[model samples]
Target: MNGVSEVFSTILLTSIFLALVFMLLPFSYYTIMGSVAKTEYEYVKHGFYSIATYFPMIATGGEYSIDFPSQYTSRGYIETGRIDIYLNSSSQPTLSFPCMALTQGASVGGAPRGLLYGVDTYIVNDSRMIPRIYEYRDGNGLMIMTLDTCRLLLDVNIVPTGNYSGYYYVLTYYNLTISFRGSGSLRIEPVRMYTVYSNIGGNLWNITIVVSDYILGKSFSYSVIDLVKMGFGKEYAGIPFSLTIVVEELVVEV
Candidate 1:
């Protein structure tokens, strides 16, 4: 009788131990998985925010390739209504990148206004407008575009004339990183020109350049002529005449 009782007690304790382990297994798994998922979400969020700030710093015209987590896909655009970047996400880990442009006065209308973040406003007048929209890709691939600078020169070789139709404007690029291809073309558009005499006058212009890259999401137009136009004509000709540009540099940010 004593032996039998001991055997029964041992059996009962073994069964109880197994039951307890089975009960706790699922709870342990649940806790671990939840923590892992939360970690992933936080990490991805940090990366998304970083992109919002980092992009504009390098958003000059050119091909760009950025590496992101394998699970996410992102695209970027410059808002014309206001100076901001709107990021769109389409994937498992959805997200958005939104922020003001590093440079200011980047509006749809080509009129020059305030400086963007204290940086000089480069594009001015009706000639060049804000780059309305653009996009990016996942897995950090490649971006290629033409980058150039529009310099307002008080003195240049351009002869001032009433008709001024006979003079051809040359746009020379300085920090150009990518080569021209496909339907890519450089065009000089006349925005507005005011002339006092032949050599003394102001001209507002819109310079447009086309870039072709599958990596880039869309085509955009913007200029830096306005930022450099400030404080120059204020000294000369009572009102001052400012409308001369020299293509200074060629390169885009990545």
Candidate 2:
């Protein structure tokens, strides 16, 4: 109290000393620490967002797996499992994906060359492309390729109602969640048979099939044809042609 001027001078000296210390610090050290902390924060935020958005997409993938049977084993675990992995690479993944198939002369050496990218699906209203097919092996070991022949038994191809060919058109599309209904043990692989022939009743024709699976048509329903058209209203007793039918996620027309 006796020396007000001296007290002001002492406070000013202390403040100047603190400012000088801050200025003398190495700028790089602060810069490095700040960058690291910022990166960490951003990573955590983006990770959370990705997790939320991707969960729905994975669910969509599962909905299509509903056809598998019960009691399967995987990864040393004796439990039913479903796989939904997101990928854009060539690596064979741990995810159990269903076999994707296309028509003849496209797939070679067990790999399919397709015209479109990403998930392949068909919609009926899209008249530009034909409908997809679903051919399950029949008792006679034939892939039934006539699903649309008798769809509702109305006036259509193969009149008077016939067995459904494995081929069909998806009347609509579903962007909804993909949910799989699984059952039997599920395994996936790629297999190809270049040319196969049938000798029924001494009939001769060239038959070729390409499939990608450990066990092709093991659980499928098939049908054998005694008579098939050879074009121009001429049918053959045994006309061997490579055939394929792929069952896909379908939504009925409203």
Candidate 3:
């Protein structure tokens, strides 16, 4: 009887020990898996954090593009004056990109003088500045002096808006050239002209303008007199000074 009782007690203790180990095995596995998942989450968050700070610096240089990991899906858009990038739902986004403008180069030639650098624009704006105008008086009242007595060339760049990734160039120039000589008399009148050309996007464009000395009304009186004479007088029979130009737009695909 004593031997049987000891065997029974030993068997009971062994069974209890085995059951406890079985329960603890599952708990141990769960704890280790939880720690690994937390570590992976932190790594992904750190990667996105680094990207947010790096984007601003690259944007200033030019257009920036990048591809994300294949396992996750992402989306990018500009909203409320900022660019937002969203990665997978589980990961924090690499977001908040700075707004960047598309840029273009503008160049103006002074005929024989060559290309002027100081007046050029690396990035386009709403209103651009043209080449400097140097005026002097001779026997001919006022005239637009040219480079090496040549004509004036104006090169304009129509900068793209939004995400248009392409190359575009618009070239316009005045064919007329003026030489200041004591013999020539300055004509006080309004000069009207227009430039017609296609844009990089293959669209027709016409720009009409009236050139006059607004500061000195001297030409205004002449313009009025000419208008009166146009009714009957020969002085205003023909358009005093007018120019019209048309050209196919110069587009370079890059």
What are the RMSD figures for all models against the true structure?
Answer: 16.2, 21.7, 29.1
Query: Which model is ahead, 1 or 2, in terms of TM-score?
Result: 1
Predictions in order: lDDT: 0.30, 0.26, 0.28
Model 3, position 204: C-alpha lDDT score: 21
Best by TM-score: 1
Taking the candidates one at a time, how many backbone clashes does each contain? 28, 36, 3
Instruction: For residues 101-202, write the lDDT of model 1, one tens digit per residue.
Output: 111111111222222111122233322222222222223322211112221223323345585422222222222232222221221122223332132232
At residue 235, give the lDDT of candidate 1. 28
As for model 2, its CA RMSD to the true structure in angstroms is 21.7
As for TM-score, the candidate ahead, 1 or 3, is 1
**How do the residues 116-218 of candidate 2 rate in per-residue lDDT, one tens digit apiece?**
2111221122222222223233344322221110110001122122553221111111211112223232222112222121122232222211112221212
Arranged by TM-score with the best first, the candidates are: 1, 3, 2
Q: Residue 154 error for model 3, in Å? A: 30
